[model samples]
Target: MQFVILCKDKPDGLDLRMATRQVHLDYLKDVGGANLLGAGPFLDDQDRPTGSMLIVEFPSEAEARSFAQNDPYAKAGLFVDVEIRRWRWGVKPPAA
Candidate 1:
């Protein structure tokens, strides 16, 4: 099953986010990386990253929680809030 991880950064956390970005990317490149489908940061009104979202496949919610808990950003306490939910793939749109 696919899981969606939504995370909101702590206030004044941009520096931490920038510093830990590569480490987070590296985490996704390591073990349990295969489940990774896609990930991106959420932008604020000023176009600054304020949060992040990652979609990954996992056999259970336990695994999904582990993935989120182990992320570099999470380890560094960059997120103020994190939500994990099972995601169902929707019908794809036809080509234009």
Candidate 2:
């Protein structure tokens, strides 16, 4: 199954995020495989990063959720909120 891991940073979390970025990237590298589809930071109104989004595929929901829970940013308490949800890639037609 595929999961979308969404995290929202606390207002003052930029420092924590920046400090933990290398570890986080390293963790991603350790876990990356065919299942690790994509990941990136989310920017705020002023273009400062405020959160993160990770797309991953795993055998089950438990594994996916576990993956999110173990992220370095998450472990460092950089996020105010985190959400992990099942997802699927599908075709979407353009709006009229």
Candidate 3:
């Protein structure tokens, strides 16, 4: 199954996000179960990062949620709120 991982950063937590970005990316790269289809910081009205949005694919919703829970960003307390929604990918050709 695919899941949309919507993460809203804690207030003024951009520093934390930047600090753990490398580890976060590494974790995602090594987990090997979920696929990070698309992800980026959610910009506020002033064009500052207020949160994140990620589209991931896994074998099950549980797995996807697990990935989100164990993500380095979550562990670092960068997220004020996070949401996981089962997703359907009806776009064009899949990523190569």
Candidate 3 lDDT over 9-38, as tens digits, reads 999898998899999888878873348887
lDDT on C-alpha atoms for all candidate structures: 0.91, 0.88, 0.86
Who is ahead in lDDT, 1 or 3?
Answer: 1
**What ordering of candidates by lDDT runs from best to worst?**
1, 2, 3
Cα error, residue 50 of model 1, in Å, equals 0.5
**Model 2, residue pairs in steric clash:** none
lDDT-superior candidate, 2 or 3: 2
Where does model 1 exceed 4 Å of error?
Answer: 93-96
Per-residue CA lDDT of model 2 for 1-96, tens digit only, reads 878999999988999999999999989989756668889999989998999999898999889888888889999999999998999866662232
Write candidate 1's Cα lDDT for 1-96 as tens digits: 989999999999999999999989889889556788888999999999999998888999999999999999999999999999999768672232
Error of 1 at 25 (Å): 0.7
Worst 10 residues of 3 by lDDT: 31-40
Clashes of 1: 0
Q: Write down the TM-score of every candidate.
A: 0.91, 0.89, 0.85
lDDT of 3: 0.86
Error of 2 at 96 (Å): 30
